[model samples]
Target: MSRYQQASHVFWRCQYHIVWTPKYRFRILKDNVGKEVWRCIQVYSAQLGCEVVELNVQIDHVHLVIKVPPKISISKLMGALKGKIALKLFSKFPHLRKNKMWGNRFWQRGYFVDSVGINEDIIRRYVRHQEKMERQEQAELALD
Candidate 1:
């Protein structure tokens, strides 16, 4: 049971199971590289206000369970996470670019995203509340 996030009229617990892989599914995420990947995920996720509930960096692919806010789009969230991790990973381990990758591309294009939990009604209610709060905030700001 994850803690629910509350803001004005909104209350949510948005969690997702995300999976992705390196270019060509290479078994390069080992030893230091694996450790670095985990670190990057935590650091980058924190910067984006997302909580990583669980993470596993296998040799070829990575699995992550993350909780994000309702206002953030899945595409934007994934893009930021993958982009920052790749940038940092490449910079820290330049040797990876020698032959494993090309043109600074580390992780492959596109990823898998699945909303966690089985309570669709709960998520729906939270989304509705979040929208209502946003509208109210905008109205209040407009009055000033």
Candidate 2:
């Protein structure tokens, strides 16, 4: 294969982090629509030339770690993923409109992104800690 073809054929890995919450941090994402929202994110990410490495859907927000090719711009990729997902989600879940998931918009505005390196330990810890933190929050809430 030519160099260009070889490069294109080779998988490029990147980690994309995204976070968005319901207006006023409402826990509307605990229902069936929550799963749908996550599926939408996965579909949109694939369309943007990325593979999801990990995803965490909290009660209020979401976190995603994805792998993407070098050819795609972060901004364009995020735009496509968030935009398409939001459009589809709001369309399918009409209640989202009432909640104002977006203040006249879908997603907040921007998301967090991180480049993963060879630090497997760090990545694992972060992913694990995400869940732990969620559990802790739930526990604390239960006490209240």
Candidate 3:
């Protein structure tokens, strides 16, 4: 499981690996643009009460691993994030807004999100050692 966070009545761990590409897969994110996008995501996630565990901005797409609260729906979060980030980029980097082909849109409408739940190490240990644990218990029972 992911690192759980607790409130007075809520103890939860909900994380996701999200991937989104630019419109028509244009390789526009580079240098300042990429850095700015990364910063925007980080700052915005924090502002929205989410924790950005990892962010990778590629030329055409971005990969973000984030810890989000159970209360927020993924669709709503993405819609807000994509819209705000696009507006910020268009304003700060006017050249990006000038792209006629892209018009005013920056990101693709559809995005990919996978639940990053249940760590690999724990699964591996359980799969490899469950029989051993059962055997140890059986031995102890026989002694008693």
Best by TM-score: 3
Q: Tens-digit lDDT track for model 3 on 1-144?
A: 546897678998888778898999998899999999989998889888899876777777887778888888889789888999999999999988878987789999899988877663443344345546667998999999
What ranges in model 2 sit over 4 Å off? 1-6, 9-11, 137-144
Candidate 1 lDDT over 61-82, as tens digits, reads 8878788988888899889988
**Which pairs clash inside model 1?**
none
Each prediction's TM-score versus the true structure? 0.77, 0.76, 0.79
Candidate 2 lDDT tens digits, 6-25:
25467444565556665566
Please report, in order, the local distance difference test score of every candidate based on alpha carbons: 0.81, 0.70, 0.82
Ranking by TM-score: 3, 1, 2
Name the lDDT of candidate 3: 0.82
Given candidate 3, what's the lDDT at residue 81?
A: 88
* Each candidate structure's count of clashing pairs: 0, 0, 0
Say which candidate scores most in lDDT: 3
